[model samples]
Target: MKRKEKFENRKTVRKTECRRSRNLGSCPAAEVSKLQKTVNSFAYTLEKAHFLDYVQYASNEKRIFRRAFLTGLLRGFGTAVGVTVLGAVIIYLFQALAKSNLPYIADFISDIIDIIEKTRK
Candidate 1:
């Protein structure tokens, strides 16, 4: 019975020592510090990548906006010029038609004047 009790106590001591050693072996101070630094740097790198992507997206948007603005400006200018030319042409044709009918209008007026004179006499 004495030997069995002694053997049991020795086994308990060995188990405690093994547990402590295992806990110490899992994470040393140097490795724990290195892991913390790695985690921080990983987070920083992701932030940088996101910032760069945002910059690129903004640049592309700016370029597209400028192109749209320029295109709208040119189209507006062209429309203005085309409308002005079309208005001028319509006015010129109306004036030409009036001039061409003037001679007929004058002859009708002269015939009316002659008839009135003959009727008075």
Candidate 2:
């Protein structure tokens, strides 16, 4: 009966105990301390189970979606612009090389284009 009383009372909140009795000197203090520790640990764990709440605590769905979409669209746009600039540079180089005094340079460029076309096949 005493053990059941003690167990029920153990889970309830109370102040730090310092009571003393025969055959149980300092034992109540230990029991109270252990119960308090368990309570504290449970409270701490309860505070952390809100995973989704923590993630969406300060974020709006529309804002996140807008940022992601704009980022991807801008990335794709920049890549297309970069490829166009690179192709222009290559064409300009080929035109300059064709007008040069070296006669074999044009043949070399044509051969390279042929090789590229063959690879596509």
Could you say which candidate leads in TM-score? Answer: 2
User: What TM-score against the true fold does each predicted structure earn?
Assistant: 0.36, 0.42
Model 1, residue 81: distance off in Å is 0.3
Runs in model 2 with CA error above 4 Å? Answer: 1-58, 110-121
| lDDT of residue 29 for candidate 2 | 69
Candidate 1 yields a Cα-based lDDT of 0.73
Model 1 segments beyond 4 Å from truth?
Answer: 1-59, 102-121
lDDT of 2: 0.72
Which residue window of length 10 is worst by lDDT in model 1?
A: 90-99
lDDT of 2 by residue, 11-116 (tens): 5533224333334454556676786799999878867887567568547888788888999999999999999999879867876775674778887876666676
